[model samples]
Target: MLFTYPIAATADNWVSTTLLELLKNAVEYLQNAQEPDGFQESVPEEYQAEFARGTKFPDLYAAFVDQCRLLNDQQRDLVLKALAGQNGFPGLFAANTPCPNITVTLQAVNQATRSLFEYAFGKLSDLKTPGSVDTVRARYHQLVHSHIASGCCPFCGLEILEAPDPDLVDPDLDHYLAISKYPFAGANLRNLTAMGTTCNRSYKGAKDILLNELNQKVDCIDPYGDQLITISLAGTVLLPGGGQGPAWVLSFDPDALSQNWRRIFKLETRLQANVLEKQYQTWLESCVKYAQKNGIDISLKEGAIEAVRKFRDTCEYETFPAIARLKTNFFELVEAELNDPQDGDRMHNFVAAVQAA
Candidate 1:
């Protein structure tokens, strides 16, 4: 499940371009490292098959793959040897420090993977041709957009569009099984559906047990594939003393428990704290901007105004303008402190703070 805000495809130009270049470089770099032995000697055979045979650039790909795996204690020695190469940096100038090698490799792999999606979904019009022999590549492209537009939360089938950053939230059609590793005919995209960012983040790096369980659970519906419902705000109820007005509530079908639910839950909690929190904060800014651009009524407090002014005054002007244009509802809700004169007590307050004034 990957939640995303919708920026016009064009709005993502820089990110898209940089990622594509990175992927191309990675591919080219890996391709150049192929040895006479047919394998890169660095990357394992299983991994290399994901890309085309002639396109294998063992050295570069191995270095990059190793770096990402390093954090999780994955295979590293093999990756390093591939990156080190016979002369080291055969194409680029040789350097003693391996940081460049690692960095280049990571950037390449990350960009390449992203580019695969980009091209698959037609982000880079020039790279639309299918690269692999996957029979359903065309269907894959169509399904990506359909799944995204479908709005079903990938995890647990909860409706998230009504929750927040609806546009930024992206739906993912994920494999219930690890098709790459477990290629049973049933392990195809048929077991996929739309998922939210929170779900995906929580489910991140859960390949072994979760994948297996998902495969087992696959049935005819694939709720997301069928598009049974659209997530929307059902109702709002006023609270006493205007405290947190109309607590927004959402409803969705109960998510089926996977055998790895415990692990997924643990991962989700961590992702909520780390990845989703950051994404929420970032999306808040975008929502505010979108509101501002559309001429919606919004308000902000003095502190927020000051921060915006300071950010605008000191930083590069180009970036701040976008921040200045966020929606009113997008303002972060922070409580303020108020004194009860009669009781001589203090209470929290609601402060409307603009993420980007």
Candidate 2:
């Protein structure tokens, strides 16, 4: 996935205003209701009665208060820091200190915040309407769209259209950390990413990218961080019993988190023959056309090399990355053939076919 640009801090940004406001409100509203032991039993009579009524508001408030009471000053600050987009609290556990119950507090906060956010901004389901405005969601959407020049889903590298009609929905805002599993991160702006509907819903539903085979928690690459996992086209291989001639495969560096991302997202499998062939064909046609127009011999190799480099550079910003990487790998293979005397005929036949097509 392409790295997402970090959201700049501004006075009017949602994190500085809406999120902080909600958090402060939550703390204040629940303050009087919180007992020394962090239970509602010793609270005022009205609050006790409200809790006894079994309403969600009182329950959520109690959970928030209880979690806060359990945390030390430092831990609480960590949560605040995370909320402010300065750090990632849950990801901290992947490193040195393990805060197991932090998730509990975060979950409570997420549940309460979602209810409060929806109350203020209207229901999330109704966001498709042109008139509907959720400040938080809107800001996140704008941040993503503005940052990603390719205008494609970072995960799948598929084109994400900005509909001319305001009523039409854009890409889905995927919670990088699933809200169901990591509720505390639910409202964290850094955890939200804009992705295509298929990548967000179909392939990556509720799966934890932060865990390993042993179910132990590990840190997933933060798409907004300075450090990002790089992806490259590994090689092309012929399927065992295939109608398609060859398919390109992808490979990542030795980083475990990157590997986990590939496995969880099924990157290699998703970009198989059917998905990449069109892109490969396009690259080939472009190269052939360039050679013919320039009156350059396709067999001389310089035109082919130059064409591939130009296409790869342009694809880096203009096309879907999966297709772009496919082009890179395809040209590399062609270059390898050109360099080998025995493979010259194979390369010539390939170029001839591309020209004919």
Candidate 3:
């Protein structure tokens, strides 16, 4: 991730809490098989009518109830272990860590445990209760606008996250934890975050942060966490024997996080293709113009070096029309190229081009 997402009073665990409460009720409903009553009351109040047997909406919980009655002793135990276990979906997502994944599968009870939460997760929109997805989204809008950089994705500052408004379409709430492959965090606000369309769907789609493709255990990052990772340009790598064009090198700090992040989102490759490769020379031109406007003569290598550093300092925060980290690092690259005598005045000639324009 590029920067940490701010968890405000707005980004509550309302959806998550509601899901867990339903799961808890499910655990008890299965345990007291002596009488299979009170199953209707276990459902969230807003969607209770829908869950009732002869309702306009389908009785989604009816199958679960029937399955619970037919549970063998071992299956009943599986329900308890999965829903009631300390390290179950509730606990693992509550902490939002990748290690110590919930080992108990919901299939332990032939998916009798799955219906309750999944059904309720869908109904969070109709919830008049304070915890509706609408209430959360409204709050998220406020929190995002106030706390995070405007139109910036906390995952990667490169993409644009449209400013959400009530009348217009909403942003995509990306699940930090892969709820599709792993169970539990589907509706949890803790697991949810707003990301760019490309970031959410294209790159970070359903890739389990907790487990790699080989099913190896990996570390996870909290979507609403405070830990910030650094994306820096280490330097440029030139092609051997010289005519193919220089290759860019990006460095991400706190290597462990970088490895998993890069693996999940293909962060380095995306930045190289989308931002660096396409924008490098254009960005250099902007930097030159910015420095020239500020009365710094960028024609000289010394002046160009000063321009790079000064422009970098201005990009410390992600503001409109500029990716803070990208500009900062690109300038760092410019400064590096300015200092390197081997490139035969690569950036110098680039600066000369800007001056001519």
Tens-digit lDDT string for candidate 1 (159-208): 44222232543344343433232221111233333345555555633363
Q: Pick the candidate with the highest lDDT.
A: 3
Global CA lDDT computed for model 2: 0.55
**Residue-wise lDDT of candidate 2 within 1-357, one digit each (tens)?**
555555541112332233344454445444445443333443344334422433343455445555656555565665555444322433552534342323455655455544533332322322222223544455556656777777777776765746324587866767676655545455455566667788878877888766665776666666666555566555655232245666555677646657667777777677764466545667678777776776766664565555545554555444676666656666666666655687655666666667777
Q: Is candidate 1 or candidate 3 better by lDDT?
A: 3
Q: Pick the candidate with the highest TM-score.
A: 3
Model 2 bad stretches (over 4 Å): 9-134, 161-165, 235-244, 297-317
All models: lDDT?
Answer: 0.32, 0.55, 0.61
TM-score of each: 0.28, 0.67, 0.79
Model 1 alpha-carbon drift over 4 Å, by segment: 1-135, 150-175, 179-183, 186-189, 192-267, 274-276, 279-348, 352-357
Residue lDDT tens for model 3, 1-357: 666556673245554565456555654666765454354565577645434532322343455556655766666565545433322432343324432223354343334334444544454444433434455456665677667656677666766676666576656777666654444455565556778787788888878766666776555555566656877667666322355555777777777755776777878887788777787667767787898799988778788778878887887664733356777766666677778888638767766777788
RMSD values for the candidates in order, in angstroms, are: 18.2, 7.7, 4.4
Rank candidates, lDDT, best first: 3, 2, 1
Clashing pairs in 3: none
